[model samples]
Every structure is written in C-alpha cells, then in structure tokens.
Target: MQISSNEIAWRGGKVVLVLPLPGVKQTPPDSPQLQALYAKLEGARSGGAAVAPRLPAADYHQCPRGTSVRWYCFYQNRDWNENVAGRRLQWSDPHCDEVMDFEVYSFAGQTSSWVNTGFLEVTVWDDSVHRLWTEAPNSLSAYVGSSNNDQARFFEACA
Candidate 1:
C-alpha cells in the first residue's frame, strides 16, 4: 500500500512508523490489503466497532547481517483490567541485523499509574528483525512462543 504521510489520520496513537518496503511494489488504494487497512482505521476513527485485519502470518527468516524486521502490539491498563488488543504490520530490510529486544511499559507511558495488569499478546511477522523492551516496575514475563516468527507471547502484569 502506498500511503503518503498526509493520508494517514492518527486517531489515538502518538507515533506511527512508516517504513519503505524494498521489494514489495506499492498497491493501489483499492487493493484488498490496503482497503482493509483503511477501513480498519476508518472504523476506529468513527468510533465504530473495528475488526482486526487479516495480516500475513509472521515467519522467522534468517536476515542478513544488519537487517531486521519487527511487529508488536502494546496494551496498558489503569484500574480494572479489561480485554484489549492491538495489532500492526511492519516491513524491514530483508538483509540486516537480527535482534529481538523485549521491553515493557505501562499504559500511555504513565509510570505512576496503577500496577500493570492484564494480558498482552506479541506476534512477530515476516523475516525482518526488531527489538522490544518494557520499563522497570512493569512486570512482563513471556508466557509462550517457540520462535520469533508467529510466536504468541502473552505477558501478564506481576501482582
């Protein structure tokens, strides 16, 4: 999908990373994937129930030195824990360093809020490499996942 900077209307997210896809050709706005992505965003913008897009399953790839790709979703809870979910896809250089870092943070970057609670699922897709990490006081423990690609890691806040 070819979404120039101006086309993206952020509703709540503070930062959205848009990276150049090396080999993947840009798809017209009407393409299925692009359409789904747009609709998903529009639903969220309009405060309607948004459905998660069917993204390509992630598979660990042997990236060349210095190239990597990473995909992740972060959830933060304040008072009572509720079921929340976030998903995204990213493209990275096929041949780069492969590093996956795990860092945890509280909801909305607020460190003094309630204790970290609820479950967060992290899924890495494609062959690119990336890093993830949480901050101190936020207890995040990986629950599952055999490999980086398509692994489901559930992190529950420490009591």
Candidate 2:
C-alpha cells in the first residue's frame, strides 16, 4: 500500500497506527492497540489538518562528535519489532534519486541503530542506471567523511 502522507492524524495530537493507504486491510477494529490508535487518529481528523509536523528529507547528515559528521537513514515498518534480522534503509540524494537496501541493525522495541560491518562502499545505482560509489575510512572520525547518503549506501551493501 502506498503511504501518500508522511504526516497523519490532526494537529496538536499524536497518530496511532499510521493509516496505510486505503485498500490495505484496516487494522482489526477489535484489537486494543488498534482501538487506541484509531482514537488518536479520529481526534486528529476531527481537529483538522494543521497538527502534522513537517518531515525532513529521507536521509540527513548529523555530527555525532563535535568535529565528525555521519549520515543517517530513517524509516518505519509495522513488522519492525526489536529483534528483526534485517532492516531496509531507503533514501534519496543528488547522485541517486532513490536507493533501498537491507542492512544489519538492532531495534530496541521501536528504535534501531546501524552497526558498521567493516565494508564501506556505495554499491547502488542512480536513477539513470549509473552506479554511484564512495569510499569510507576505517574510522569515521572528523574530516574523514560527511554524507548520510554514503553511510546508508555502505550499510545497505553490507547487508
């Protein structure tokens, strides 16, 4: 199912189960979790559309250390429990408009962090079918590199 809106529910509130595109089976109405989620969405819907937050790019750069920068890929999946074997990271960039790949990571209930697997390289192709690539140093220290696209691509390739 296609998720048309990144922001669901109404303004000044929270969203429960992000409604998947229509035609996707609605969550079981009797389920308690589903009920709670429905209530939040209903409140948002009645409250109007002004409550949603603006979403940033699919992937973005961040500086963990004062001088070092790293890339991060963000996403969510219903099946993404705390112990999934693999997670897919998707992102976009100038070199590659869209890229998706599986990566090794551990989710702690709802959040997960990427772990380096030692192989750092962008092994995906751009929208035009041209392969996009980059090289990463053993340590992602300051001045080493600074691009979420490259970091995400490398993890995806390793997976």
TM-score per model over all chains: 0.19, 0.20
lDDT of residue 112 for candidate 2: 28
Model 2 error, position 157 (Å): 1.4
Candidate 1 per-residue lDDT, tens place, 89-123, comes to 22211212332222221122211112111122222
Model 2: lDDT of residue 95 = 23
lDDT at 17, model 2: 22
lDDT of 2 by residue, 117-146 (tens): 123333533334444433342222212123
Candidate 2 residue pairs in clash (backbone atoms < 3 Å)? 10-44, 11-51, 71-148
Model 1 misplaced regions, further than 4 Å: 1-35, 38-70, 78-108, 111-159
Q: What does candidate 2 score on TM?
A: 0.20
- What local distance difference test score does each model get? 0.26, 0.28
Worst 10 residues of 1 by lDDT: 60-69
Among these predictions, the greatest lDDT belongs to: 2
Error of 1 at 59 (Å): 17
- lDDT for model 2, on a 0 to 1 scale? 0.28
